[model samples]
Target: MPAPSSTASAFLPVVPRLRSLRNSITLAANPIPVLDTYLNTYGDTIVVYLGGIRRTVLTRDPGLVQHMLQKNHRNYPKSDLSHGVARYLGHGLLTSEGSYWLRQRRLIQPGFHRQRIAGLVALMQTEINDCLEPLERQLAKQGGFVEVAVHALMITTAFRIIARSVFSNSLAERQLHRMAELLTAIQAFYVRTVRQPYLRPWQHARGQFRRHDQLAAELRDIVRGYIRQRKEASGPVPDDLLQMLLDARYEDNGEPMTEEQVLDEAAILLVAGHETSANALSWMWYLLAQHPEVVTKLRTEITQVLGDRPATFADLPGLGYSLQVIQETMRLYPPAWILDRVAQEDDTYNGLALPKGTLISGYLYGIHHSAKLWDEPEAFRPERFGPDQVRQQVPYAYIPFGGGPRLCIGNQFALTEMQLVLLEMLRRFDVEWVEQPAIDLMPLITLRPRQEIKVRFRRHKA
Candidate 1:
């Protein structure tokens, strides 16, 4: 990695630095804000030195992003940073590489096909209604405030949806809650390990790593138990992800997946399945709350399209404005805000040379907020996503779900789920923000709102 540029050195005083041993621990504890500060001051792209490792951040140029993610992907492979995460996730699609990743990707790609996802839209609607019914009753009677983090609620809902879609009875509240807790613990540990790699050796002795391992084991056991029960039963195969995976056979070998592979893939699906969607929903709600006109317009569109009925798969296409709202929200606060890759071999982009093993972090936040690419980049405007308007933007200027061969496979599923949930919630209730609360970016495995998003939902009169 190259040394910090003269510009970086010039801004050293403004950058937050760890002062003491205690402060260093705290800095390692949460460097998200510090990173955001650097991006804010350095204008999209900047090099930062963190714990002796130098990282080059590219945020302003979308063509650069496209080159790295799609055009020149072979040159850059998934970074070693993902290795620690794979310990818990297993060699699932998200973590696997080389032939393993290729095989998994090909096998699972069909499960997310448009036709397959369309079949699950009804299931998603059922789950959304199940979740919203109680909230609707609460809004009708007492007009209580929804103080929970929107991201957390969205994840909870998405998890149940994905769980039910995978294992018919996997939506049990207790099971979902347990899984959520375990996933949270695992992610927390992952954040700590990534920010401070030096502490990894002591993580096990300190009980933190042990706790994560235990949670991962417990999760695997839960999945294994589900698989075992499904196998024992002589009943009909359900039309869910689990069944799909069960039916899936390797094209070359015609061999069924091993039990361990099944469990690992299922776990990966559960984690990646909910986190990104939930974060998108949470950010969408936040954006909607900020822009009342947009909210009103969305409500009007939903009312006209659904006409007091729940949103169905067919209703989705007509919810174009709602889609735009979600798109704009993702633009402003993308959940998968950063993507990283380590050079597998020496590579060059434009004219700059990248050596082997150099870690490159793509800043989606900076790319979305870059004034050079976006007009009035800081403001929330859904019109920017209008069909013609979107055409005007650069190819990679607006990649919320990422791009390229390894582009998120669940993008279509997530978009449909978010659209359905947003329409359902907005149709039944009015979400009004309490106040513009302190906005802090907690960039972990995904970008998350630091504080709880408190809002009041008033049930719409019939």
Candidate 2:
């Protein structure tokens, strides 16, 4: 209930700490609805106490998000809310800040370039095909229809694609599964600690923190072993992300990243590369199952462009509707749903005052769903992203991959991978809705379905 550092905040509405405290339990369970309720009640921008512990400004204002993320980004580096992940994930691009982050970004940028990702298309498709083999087998045995837990399937499929993309054949299947498990365990626990800051002492007393730290160490060891294998390998270097990181040399001194640095970046890539795409692809299937009309339109575009042939890197650009579906899915269930930034200095947007050291939580989910920004904001309409429609919207209102100078480094890579997965899966199978309980959102580090999304996939009849 104490006043903020600056009077500029007075211009904004305040959700009392007590109210946020009362809602903290609900917020911890699923923050999207709790946050949406707050935004819906108190304009687009307001101040609320996070976890009833820290007073912070929460805004779904596209202008404010753009201002913090793009316009004057230097004054608004990622807050501890982001850095806190480094305890488990390491200080890679996602958790790092300032000049070091810039350097790493510059060094790793080329690896994700259009030309580079284009080259990886075959690798991605091969992995995608491999992932679908089991489903194909199930359909064959079950009279051409098989029920699948789509979220679990997408998680496995996405992790393989990213792992192969990063380590190529260096990691064995067992090792890959182990790494995935460790990452998931660490991330899930980290989210619990963050959402319930009051439980830190209890978690620590119960040795949960120590156990997760050990898990993180094991993850690092797995990655480090692979990096060392690449370093000690005797043959031609495999064309993979690990190689790309190995070959990258800083512009100034022309020195490659150290072993520890490589481990940090590689771990970050594995964590970042898989989770968002997995969640997006999972949500994409969920949405498509409910809306067969949308799926039919998608098939039309695919057949027109690809016929019975598989889509290659060149064929992807022509598949516009597929990308729009992915875009719209992200709009509905953005993986990186909310972002946190802390002000390093006093600043103001329009008439609102922002004192130095202000903590701002840019609610991207709200911005994407704001009635003021979109007509029928809750509807799933891929056409909204069509060329003309996209230009009609406000900037930063549709930032599924985030925006500004620090835009997701792997945005193009994620889009290409998601598009390829969608095309390949639809081309091979018919995704049908399977009756189940209504799916609820579980907004952890990423937005996921609270329960398994069950869907039936039948072999495509040409």
Candidate 3:
């Protein structure tokens, strides 16, 4: 993909099974600190037993990560750790592989092009303003400042943006809430099963798997109903993601995707599109509240670009600082903090041997926060993304959206959404830090704050 950042050492370290077993509970509770401890004790790349059962090679080495994700991606497909979600989310882009994934990728990639995303700007802004109205009312009633649980607020805003972008007005408010609830429940349970494999037998005895499967079915049914409604409508199809999927034709054969295929991809789009942005936005507020200087700088940029107006897609490019803030937030707290891939066949990187079927956990969080890679890994600084500064950084060392051929399809959409949210919120309100205990990381299917993060929003005064 890019030049190897550094040479990977041939010597590999392994954490003993007994130690891993002993630390299983601690790892399940919060793996970031524990994993960091291991990497510190051992080296960048080490073999460890996940839950003390599954043998896995976990590494934060950027060179190896690029090798697996780009240089030889075909030789590394998503392992069962990732595909496990397919059992609940269906064989969408996030879960599917081989010719099917490639075909679907080619078919759907155009839908997220820069121009297509620009088309959805108005749709995104509409939803964002709607989401902000209630908070605005709250501020008016409370005399200018309102304390909010930023994570919950971000979740609602993000879901509405993605849901409306995809389905338009096809889904009612009640159904929208229900779909969000079901997806959350299924993902929570899925992460539990993966983290605590020892509890699976008991989980099975308790019908947890069956229950989540039912939730999955219910989620699909809700989307299916709306899809069928659109198919039966006589009028012209609305300009939304669902219609885009319906209208896409495969190149080899001019056939459109099947109903099931549409459902799977749409479901995938909903999940992938919303979750990452929501988490990143939540963490962005967390950082901004504490770093008011950064917020002040943001307000300056916002004022220079669009004084007395909300941002449109055309206005985003001028708001480079907003984008840098988002890029920095993701660097510190990446939503898809870690990614999994398995060696399709025997392979070598630098000098380490990876046999067929060997599981490799690309510790993206570790890579992002490594002191060797970043000047101040823990500090929040958006200036690192300035044009000149960015060019000098090592490649793959800052992959919040990942690297290589199979990079996140919604990367542009996500960046645009986050930038819009930051600019809009700061344009209207002054984000102030509220007194609370320090936030802890909750590494679920996505990285989340363990405790609620509260921030105060004061209406801006010129």
Candidate 4:
């Protein structure tokens, strides 16, 4: 609770000693356990010093989180420290701040309009179904228990859908494959760089930075080439995401995005949509398999809504329980398990003041799992998100997609994709956990299962 360099009895309890190499090691390996310990032992406002210089306060208090992320959002600009992706992906929506971010958000916001995203539901379903052909073939050839890696399957399908939606189907398999490889590499390196900053010298010695730059250049070229193709497509510009970006003009001066800006946005779109949706669906499948009762309820709702047909946008509104299932799934395993915002100026909250440059993270996992907020916090109870039930929960307490102005722009798109995929999954097969895969949480850029989550996809009875 104590802000760094402040008076000891300054209206809040300090994380005594404020430094612990033991907890630091635990934080690097998996921050969840350490955070859980902090929540239990130190209570909400837990502070830690990194390398004996930077101060990071982990806050799980919902009202204070509301004040920080929403009430006084302007005072909490994103820290450059968390922009590790910019080194690999450049300054895009997720990394940029101030006027640049605002400009981009305004210009790009139209692309995700409800009608536009709703129109893509058919396109989304097509990509998922086409990708599943191979799976269906495998299910036939390999029999009941397909034992497929769920994360890989979901990512592949979601990636293709996003690529088509963004680039207007311009990316060839070769181009897509190369882009995928570079993105995966960049993500791995970015996560490592952020988690282990002291290893930068060692990383540089191994040419990690040089190699990442090269890969980034190639990815940028692929995206820029697609933008050029869209611009020169001859006909009236196709009504796709690429066309939208190309068409976006600043309200202040009517200036269009530069080619580099276009590439940055395109790259972020692909990276953000692919990884986030995949993580959500993978965990949903895992949770559904583990909780058969929820699955049964979900399946019942699916049957009542679609009645043996493939799901569509029209079906989503009626799929209330289905939506709740996703909501609850996210509550348990939010894709972005943590978010950071550096204090732009000294600010006080909940009787504690933070110094400028103090990195503040609303420990999302800790907040979502707080016993003070949720009943049976560790249990997977989808009904907790039922309309009436969720109304009682605080606004920032269940921020699966985040809150405030920085709330995910692709929120609608992700939900639509997830809804369609979940419908397809539930309708097509009887899901079961393969090999009793022990749940090992991987707190990477997204929350992912540590090991390959193999699932048995038996054909459901007709």
Candidate 5:
């Protein structure tokens, strides 16, 4: 058998100062620059200390990532950070570990099947139109000079799509607004907790825990009400994700999940299903705005296929270039920028020994922009993902949604949502950048654009 790779301590020089609380806060708050410097200066593999904890950072080496995420996955479990994350997200698929995760995965996977997703195409198109129509009318009246943050619109778009897919017009406007507010609050608190370990004592003492509890309770009540209503209603069953979950049977005993399990999974789906996709779309529009040539080319392609028609799932195959744009955008600014795993047993990689409980940080943003893996790593180049090209690339080099058994189950859902939204936006409006916005890294639960991307939209002429 092959010997284990060397531990990080043996192969990479460690940044000792990062262990200090002050230094850790700085690094956590400003991760991209630090990460870029490390990957560029220290090579693909390096170890850093965060708050006295030794963490290994692996960048750009697809072989190493594949090994960690797939080949030896059992030896590396979800990290403690994930547990903290689950505290708010509940024991859903995103947060569940061990057999609980396995069980949840088995029960929930069927709902996201391609056939089921295809059936929701019409609904997605309607949501896209609903979001675009107002923007289009505004652009026409304002002569294409509107100061709109694309990210904000993308957030609402994602929520509408996911909400309709689950409850299908059942959610009242007030309830939807409350759901958004609660989710935003939870995300803000989560960012605080992750970045400020020192604040933990005071945060808990100040009833922050109770606030989280209240938020979770509110979300659970909303989800449970929907599930209960579906159960009580005696009519033709709908073909939505919620209904799919309602019908799914456990493999072990052919039993359905309890109400709590269903609620947890539903809430997770709502949050995860929307946040990452919205971030991606927001960044893509920003990139396209800066590169007008690329935008022009995309418009050409979109206009040809859409040609005075709204884009449907049927047009997806023909929107290959548009899809490539989204892919490249994700590569440059992956929403799930960092993935963490903890060593379950001693292991070695590249002559570095890793003890049990060692945390491994897969710096995906660093990897995606690594010079060794990508040429002109900082530039926007959608053709990199052309039909004849991507297969030749290394497997884990482009893990926007991640890899292995724990790969994002909603990968297809996010992709479909992006494609539909991008195509529809391009079909109805012309987006132009107001200015070259500063790109700052907000490394929380997901990486977000620190500065809102402002753009002016012009209505497309038939």
Candidate 6:
């Protein structure tokens, strides 16, 4: 279907002031409940007022999502709130907008090209095996279920792929840990600041912003050190992500990215790529733990595809069911749960007036779970993403990586990396949750599990 027409108004039924205040409070603490309550009560779209002054039009309409994200995308720049992220990540792809974003995107896009990323599959597999092998050996020694949190495992693996594969030896463990510290610190600050804007003065008074700036500077210096090393190295330069970034030039002036821009992009990828992929993969394992039948199906697919071998680049296509499982997991627990943009000018969409500076939150979580969009939308049904079913999917209905021009550049890399990691995990172990499901979301820079998910891994039997 085409994008939503401008003739249609945003948010079908506006939430009244009194109710909006109550809902707004709930949203600051836990948005999932608030979004669900209102989305069901107000149809696909709803107008919400935060603190009785800030109006956020939350919409799950696939058409409208596409309309703003793609059709008339220029009219809606990413919300100024990303400055919270910029405080840590600088003007990277995720936080940058306007001509700077465009220029930086062009410079960075080549690093994630399919061919380049394809070469990294071997690197990804090596890292996955490195992470899993020791765990498997320990599992064998234990001879039964051994509880281990998959979130940490996934996070570490993702970090290895990005840090080791791309930046290589330049990012030392100390610096990597520092990177994590900065990301966590900034995210906590950002989530708190955005959720409770009135608390900004409190945060500033508490030196939260100062600490964020300090950590951000440290992280930038770490990235810059790596970049400098690559440039100064006398040895033959490897054709990895860092090299690609160093080599990339602006299409117009043919100028290479400045060292500052390199640092920004590196910091962005280090955090965004690592966290999102890890979160998605961890959630997949969690879902599998809850759904043994789905795990069995995945096992069957993995067995049929790999036989006596490990999954490789060529094997990914045949691992269709495995990919479906990942796709379905993302649908249920999209890491980037919500997105917002500010209207650049006064406009009308289907007769709904969008005043300039209006913040529009494309409620991805709500849209993914909308009852009108799917049969049994709440159910964990991987078959829904099968070839035929995929054709029937409403555009913007499944945007784990977003869509249109602003679609995540590393989508291919993440998917392919996940394909290998998931297959390897399944083929090697029969996983079951040691603890209960990780259902509650800790909404921050990304949607994370409220509690870590513990899973017991035992060697798979013939």
Find the candidate with the highest TM-score and give its number. Answer: 2
The Cα local distance difference test for each model comes to: 0.77, 0.91, 0.90, 0.81, 0.80, 0.81
Better of 4 and 6 by TM-score: 4
Task: Name the regions of candidate 1 deviating beyond 4 angstroms.
Answer: 1-33, 36-44, 52-59, 143-149
Task: Give the per-residue lDDT of model 1 (tens digit) for 1-462.
Answer: 223344312322222223223244554645555555656665555555555343444445687678878999888778877766888878788888878888989998999998989988878888888877667666557665544457667877888887887787644578778988889889888887777767878986788877788889998888888888787878677778887887789999998889888888888888888777787788787877777899888878877888888877877888899899889989988888888887788776665556676677787887887788898998999999999998898889999988999999888888899888888887777777767656676677887777767666776664
lDDT of 3 by residue, 350-430 (tens): 879888888999999999999989998999999999999999888888887888878999999999988888888888898
Tell me the spans in candidate 5 whose CA falls farther than 4 Å from its real position: 1-8, 18-22, 51-60
Alpha carbon lDDT at 77, candidate 1: 76
Alpha-carbon runs more than 4 Å astray in model 2: 1-8
> Distance (Å) between predicted and true CA of 447, model 5?
1.4
Q: Which ten residues in a row have the lowest lDDT in candidate 1?
A: 11-20
TM agreement with the true structure for every prediction: 0.91, 0.98, 0.97, 0.95, 0.94, 0.94
Give residue 178's lDDT in candidate 4 (0 to 100).
Answer: 82
Model 5 error, position 21 (Å)? 3.9
lDDT per residue as tens, model 6, 149-183: 78889988988888876776566778777777777
Model 5: how far residue 461 lies from native, Å: 1.7
Note the clash tally of each candidate.
0, 1, 0, 0, 11, 5
lDDT of 5 by residue, 110-134 (tens): 8888888888888888888888777
Which model is ahead, 2 or 3, in terms of TM-score? Answer: 2
What would the per-residue lDDT of candidate 2 be over residues 85-127, giving only the tens digit for each residue? 9998898999999999999999999999999998788889989
